[model samples]
Target: MSFRSFLLIPLVVFLLKCAGSAEGRQSGIFLPTELHPDYPGCPAVDSSLYYYPVIGILTHPGDGASGRLSNATGVSYIAASYVKFAEAGGARVIPLIYNEPEETLLKKLELVNGVIFTGGWSKTGSYYETVQKIFKKALEKNDAGNHFPLYGITLGFELLAMIVSEDKNILEKFGSSTKASSLQFIDKANIEGSVFQSFPPDLLKKLTADCLVSQNHKYGLSPEKLQNNEKLAKFFEILTTSIDEEDQVYVSTARARDYPVTAFQWHPQKSAYEWASSSKIPHTEDAVRVTQLVANFLASEARKSTTRPDAQEVRDNLIYNYIPTYGGKAGKGYDQVYIFT
Candidate 1:
């Protein structure tokens, strides 16, 4: 070949390589290697695709019938509203079963930027054992320079507090009230200092004023319960509190002192996805705004994470392709319905 012919061959090869990489990405077959620093919290915005994050929801172990025909064993029984709540902020929520090995969970954590511990009456003692390890893993990831976030809802909040405090009695029955309650934020809860920093004053007012949050639990940590415990007080910064419909007070919400971890005692999803008339879940304009605001805040935090999913590893571990189980009052509120494996 002539010198010009040799030069033409290199140019052709370069073009082919570039085209192949682009096609692989579009097919979700290949992930590009992008340089990212290991940092905690939300990382600087550079990967636009990751801005719309795929959040992982840790499924509680429940072996009961969900409905007449529907039942679940592992991570199959996620609430429709929890999915809706996440999607409100333009994020997709996937189920992550914790029965797997520790290595498996670490890999799952690496795939997603943020994770949520959904609310339910789970085997607290055994469950917290797994959560403690995952919590430590997330802390390690953040310490090593990776931005990872964790959110606990209702039972999740209780579990988080128990793990952080190592106090099983830190949680107690709050008269087992399931009725809605108004939230009262501590003086420190606001958009400037804590998780509510991006939240609007009017929205905060609506959450407490309209009583949009759903309280369905027999046990919770009261503010007094937290203040008296040295471990809990030092580990968690109480963000909000509320009195149950039965007049029993509980710590409504909290955040970690130095991590992107937040916990909520109320179900923000109920007002939007739960349409069970018998349950009396709120579904008003302001109620939805509450879900959207919380969703957006979590999604924004997930976006701060620079962790990208592995093409082959993600397929082998997470990402279950299943048919949608549409139930509840209005049906599942979120899009991208997934099936259980």
Candidate 2:
């Protein structure tokens, strides 16, 4: 064949192949059935499931140490482990400064699909009021047909109990600080509609049989007290309990009955992320899996939210804008912390 004819023949074949591929796509032969918007008899795409979910993490007043990490006035901080946990579950984080003005704080709430009340000591004063306000907002969002989730960790759990009980003294002292404990599953029925439902059976068994969780709080609600408090009992279903150093039983895991709110008296984030020489935080594979599973659970819950916030506003408020300091070297329990002034 002539050289020019041969080149033209190759070009014609390439064009025919491209046309066939396009026809194949239009005929559903090349398109994934689940992803095609107009595929007949296929399940409709769930627009409600947002993949790029944003979580608001409430910051504590100070670093775990008093004026040790930062001495600036009106200072607040978020442990980097919590941020890492959210990311592990396929979510981004935004810091909800507890001390920010009411108007600003409420605005930030609108941007987040979920919120995490970090484990902290201040469950009173403005911080307490702020947490209560945010908790109510989350409930309101759920009540209004929007699926919003909230996670209360350690001290956050205590705050939730106190807020729901409407009693500041609801929490009793527990010698659980810096301790590793095995979760004692309460009842099989309790896990039926809860977050733990998504957990693997083997991991759930390990959670009950091994010390795969870390507890580091001075106060927690006893199972007996949680049972007697009408409001608390009505609001949350106790999932698991753990014994403290003194062998006192305290509520370790619980979830709201009607809302997408969950509370943990143990530090799930510390198991894989935080490294402190003096801490009892487990770093085993199962322990790290606990963190991963919990993170994924919360992120999945957040994805159910229908809030499609402005991308620019979310970008401005994301935790990525902040830098974390190596607090672990400073003798603090946290490996890294984002200190805000």
Candidate 3:
């Protein structure tokens, strides 16, 4: 063979090897069935009998008035974000559809370790009712000695509060308010109260004197409403009032108002501050800190799962090692990625 031909042959072989290595690293390259042929079935991880946690995320139905399907985009992004983070900490994440039948959902829930409610549009009466039933069932199961950890973000956060508090008032109070397009009422409240007017100490602490959160959602439990509703009061009493000093539940503008279930009004998945500092968008450092706190909180929750192994821990473990990517960026060793424009 000519010298040039021999050189080209070796170079082609090297290029092929590199391409194959790259393809192997990209998770999307594999089919779901190939990744886990027993999917929808309980499949053990690798050669070991051990299995990673699976997380079920509820998608937010988009604007019902607009006849839009639930905007799984944002929810999916956040879910993927948690999954990435959880995988990093040693776990797995599985996304579940909200429209699936309750029976199917429950079955899937059993196959996994936890559940997450993603944020989107306000849900209708039927959605709330269905959620209530699901919670009741879960509680019954827990009482029977089955434990599952749950997490909510934005809308999901509200759902978690409703579940623990069993207060239907959250629906009547903040539910409709989240449907508003702007912060007009919140702005008015700020002006009336000088932004530092003392709120309930517990509520104030959860909010942390951060006025920026007002920009995210206009509605929250008014002192008057909390004082008037016996059910709501009882719910809050259970979630926030009765906490032991040593309990580690982290309350934030994002997470729970109180309790093991948590929420985040802001999109931690967006990494808003990081994107903003890089001139990706206008952002505040506080936003970044909030997101990091969220990540840290999830990590903490995952660690707790080593002993508890509830649904939340199972979900957290799956997502602990997850890395964010975009497009087919999973090709770069990321389990998931955000598609932010």
Best by TM-score: 2
Identify the runs in model 3 with alpha carbons over 4 angstroms from their true place.
1-51, 62-90, 144-147, 160-215, 237-259, 272-286, 302-341
Model 1 misplaced regions, further than 4 Å:
1-49, 63-76, 188-193, 311-320, 329-341
Q: Go through the candidates in order and give each one's C-alpha lDDT.
A: 0.70, 0.89, 0.42
Winner on TM-score between 2 and 3 is 2
> Rank by TM-score, descending?
2, 1, 3
lDDT of each residue in 1-341, candidate 2, tens digit only:
89999889978997677657855446444545546667787667788699899999999998756677888888999989999999999999999999999999999999999999998789779999999999999999999999999999998899999999999999899998887989999896678767688788999999888999988889998999999999999999899999998889999999999999999999889888888534688889999998998999999999999999999999999998999988787555788889989
User: Tens digits of per-residue lDDT for model 1 on 1-341?
Assistant: 89999889988997677668855456444422332344354557665536647778775654212433335444435655666777788776556766766777666777777888877777455577877777887788778777778888888888888887787777888764456767787874343545678767788777667777777777889888888889888878888888865677788888888788888888876777666422656667887777777888888888877777766665565444434454433442322223343
On lDDT, the stronger of 1 and 3 is 1
* Deviation (Å) of 2 in candidate 1: 75
For model 3, residues 49-125, the per-residue Cα lDDT tens digits are 22444444543343221222134443334335445444443445655445556776566555554556665545556
Each prediction's TM-score against the native?
0.76, 0.86, 0.48
